[model samples]
Target: MRFLVITLIVHRPDPVTGITPSARDRLREVVDSAVLAEELGFDGFGVGERHERPFISSSPPVVLSHLAARTSRIRLFTAVTTLSLLDPVRAYEDYATLDNLSDGRLELIIGKGNGTAQRELFNVTPEDQWDRNAESYELFRQIWRQDTITAQPRYRPALHEAEVWPRPYQQPIRVWHGSATSRESVDLAARYGDPLFSANVTNPIEPYAELVHYYRQRWAEYGHDPALAAVGAGTAGFHVAPRSQDAVAAYAPVFAGQLAFQRSMGMEPVFPTLEDFIERSSALIGSPQQIIDKVHRYHEQFGHSVLHLHAEAGGLPPAEHRASLELFQSEVAPALRRTIPDPPWPWAPVLPEAAVTAAAD
Candidate 1:
């Protein structure tokens, strides 16, 4: 199974000390975490995009470009690129350039992002978000696959035999539709035979599992090979200690702070307490064996080949966070990797000859 370390780049005070780092320090930490992820054998590192308060990830391409310069092998991902709010032409150009700069080690997970603040900033109505996402993706896909394209899209300016320059390093880098609560995203992914990444953070496993099952059903309905329908899942949180009880104790304050923050935003959490969150949600807080067992249990429902855990601690100290990651790398990951098989994917970039022939005449 492929493992990814992802962060939303939230800028919140430390739960214990109530101290927040400077913007520069926070960004530096993100870069350092990506380097560490590569050193620790993670397959991918993802940076999220959000244009709201408490989030410093509004510019994913710039952040990922920095990561590309620092790391050689680990794949860089946009946890969810908020494509609905972006112009496909500009988005294509930026990511295409990033693809080249990263030597084709770029993958995208696109979504119609949540929250009213960002939607308002982008002037996107809730009614039109899904349609915008679909149209944007179709145009972006065309831009990647063809040299010249003519598109009369509803949400963006028309394209007239346009050639978006800086051809991608990967002939069509893989895209995974980020699915949260909606079937529209799932249907879109299935229609294009693209992969799906479940935002398995907010709610219980049943809803997310149902969404995955729905995605598989639609994949077959769309006549794509079942073998090729890949899926990935994200955990709410992660921390591992020498003993299960120690992990629970260590993460309690972090979870409490997170819950309080969520409630302050007028959002009611399903998992109200740390124990409830660990037991019910996808949060992986326990000993190595406990984490392994929980992953296996979720895998039974998700059939997911990729799993992403938070790279940065929400409120835990840096030392404890690093220790948890080290324990995961040394103890939990090896066992899971042995038990789970990777989903079928074309990892290598398409041949130049193939891309040339595939391009528009």
Candidate 2:
């Protein structure tokens, strides 16, 4: 299976330490984590976009552009670019430039953003956010695929033979639709024949597993090849210890913080205890073997070949964070890769699709 390290760039007091890193330092940590993810041989490193408090990842293109310069091989990802709140033209310009800067190693996971603060900030209502997301992406996809675009979109001004510059490095960049308990995103992804990325973090396995099933069903219903449908799943939390008991114990405080934060949002806790969380909730907390088994189990249900782990250290000590990730690469990743192979990508593995087509001609 392919692996990615992704962060929402949650900027808050350390749950364990009660100390918050300065904004500058927090941003620097994101850079360092991307560098480390590349060094550890992870397939991709993603930074999320959240226009709200307690998150500093509002500008994924800028952060990913810096990562492009810092690393050479790992693909850069936008966990979810929040198309609902963005101007697609501006987004296309930024990401197209980023694709060039990154030498065409870019993939996107686009979604209608959540949170009341973001919705109000962008003046997008719940009733229309999904419509906005679908419309924006339809325009964004055309901008990437065509040199000159002339179209009328509801959410944005009409374009007549418009030529957006920095023409993409990729012929048409690969996009993954990110959805959490939303059939709208799933339907859109299936309709466009794009991959689906399940936000498997917030809930139990049943919901995400069912959504993957629905995505596949919809893919077939849309007359797309079932074999071509791809899925990626996210982890709720992650830690690997030499022993199961130690792993649970080591990760207890992190879970406590998570529980408290969930409550502070005035939401009910799904998994009330750490043990239940590990047993359910898609969090990989246990010995290496246990984690490997859990991932394989999820694979059976999700049929997901790509998986993401939290890149942020969160409440864990710096050393513990580094060690746990190192251990995962050393022990857990190899096993999963052998058992679950990745689906083939539509574009050329190395060269951009444009380059490949040019060579063929």
Candidate 3:
């Protein structure tokens, strides 16, 4: 399986000390984390986009572009680009440039983002969100594939034989549809034969599993090859120590802090306690063996080939956070890599040509 480390760049206070980093410090941490992910041999590193409070990830393209300059080999991803609130033309322009800058290492996970705050900022109603997501994606696909495109979309201004500059370094960049409690996203992914990425963080496995099942059913119904159906899943949290008991002890406070934050936001958590969250949700808080077992269990249900773990510890100390990631790399990843097979993607970007060209330039 392909493994990824993702961060939402949430700017929250340290749970133990109640100290929050400055915006610049937070962004620097994100960059440092991406660098660490590559050094530790992660397949990809993702940055989330959230145009709201307590999040410094409102501009993923800019952040990812900076990462592109500092790292090589590790693919850069937008965890879920909020397509519903964006103009496809502008989004295409920025990502196309990023694709070139990253030497075709850009992969997008698109979704109609949640939360009423962003929707209000974009002047999008709840009723039109799905439609906006679908429409924007269709147009975005056209912009990447065709050189000259003439089109009219209900949500965005018309494109009349317009040419978007900086053609993607990869002919057709890979796009994974992000699904979170929505069949519309699943249907859209199935209809286009694109991959589906389940946001398996908020709820239990049942809901996300049902959606994956639905996606597969639709993929078959749409006459796409079953072998080509690619699915990715996300974990709520992660912390692996030498012993399971030690991991539990270390992460308990982090979990309590997270719950407190959720409660403050008036959001009821599905997993009430830390133990419950570890048992029921995708939080991999235990020894490496336990994490592997949990992944195998979920893989049986979702048939996912790609898995993403949180890069940031909710409120753990930097030393503990780094140690967890180190443990994952040294212990957990090797086992999982051997056990699980990677999905068959149509193509991967050829970096040699782009690298040579940039050097010459």
Candidate 4:
């Protein structure tokens, strides 16, 4: 595993402390976290897009563009851009612009977003979301590959001989389809020969493993190389401490509080009880050795090259949150890297270190 630190930019009262950071503070924290991730030798940093309450990351491109100006080596990603809700033409233009701004270090993981509130916000029904995602992705891919094209879709107008400017630095920028227990998402990724990213945060291993297996099967059916099947997985949470006991003692209450809040809001947590949560959920809240073992088990199931962790959640305090990241980078992440290979397309164009150093000055 190539480790990625992902954040939802969650803005809510901490179930433990009842404190939330200000919007200004949150923005500063995001920039600080990106910089720290690069310094800590993390391969990627991603921001999630959520249009509903308790989430502030509505504009991932804007946030990523800012981080691009500040970091040189860390790859930037969108955890999952809701392709079903946005116009493909607009997304293509903006991401292509971001590609240039970041010196070509951009990877998109597209998905039909979760949360009923988000669907209502975009006036998209659950039944129609998948179709929208398929249509939008088809147009988005075409927009990147073709210079001028005509597209006629129900959601968007026809573009006759239309051209989008400032093409991306990488010809056909890398994209991964984010799949969450949806065969449609898996099939779409397979048909396109793109990578599949499993949302393993909210479910048991069997469902996600089946989807990954399905993705590989479909890849072969689509005449793609089975050996080249690329898959990524997301972890629920991460924390590291000197000892397993110390780690659990500190995190268990926080975890339970967060779960209770989710339950109170009518959401179903994958793990109901605190004990089951620690044992079953993908959350890696323990010592470095424990975390490494857990990741190894998951690797056997998913065969994922990329593994992402949501280290901060439920409005944890900045000091506590940063400490967890510090410990993880110092102790756990390096071990995982030794086990998994780098991204297949590591040679993708990106800004040079000298350019970023000079820009900072």
Per-model C-alpha lDDT, please? Answer: 0.92, 0.91, 0.92, 0.84
Per-prediction TM-score? 0.96, 0.96, 0.96, 0.92
Write down the TM-score for model 3.
Answer: 0.96
**Mind giving the per-residue lDDT tens digits that candidate 4 earns over 243-354?**
8887777777688788878988888876877678768878888888898899889889888988887635444555766777778877787887788765565644644456
lDDT of 3 by residue, 1-361 (tens): 8889999999988766678989999899898999999998899999999988878899999999999999988999998999999999999999999999998899999999988898999999999999999999999999998999999789888889999997888767889999999899999999999999999998889999999999999999999999999999999999999999999999998888888888998989899999899999988999999999999999999999999998876688888989999999898888988988788773357444566588689
Model 1 worst lDDT window (10 residues): 346-355
Segments of candidate 4 deviating more than 4 angstroms: 311-320, 350-361
Model 1, span 1-361: residue lDDT tens? 8899998999878766678889899999899999999998899999999999889999999999999999999999999999999999999999999998998899999999998999999999999999999999999999999999998999887889899999888876899999999899999999999999999999999999999999999999999999999999999999999999989998988888887788888888899888789999999999999999999999999999999999987778888999999999999999998998787965554446655677645
Quick one: best lDDT, which candidate?
A: 1
Superposition error at 66 for model 1 (Å):
0.5
Q: Please count the clashing residue pairs in each candidate, in the order shown.
A: 0, 1, 0, 0
Find the number of clashing residue pairs for candidate 3. 0
User: Model 1 has how many clashing residue pairs?
Assistant: 0
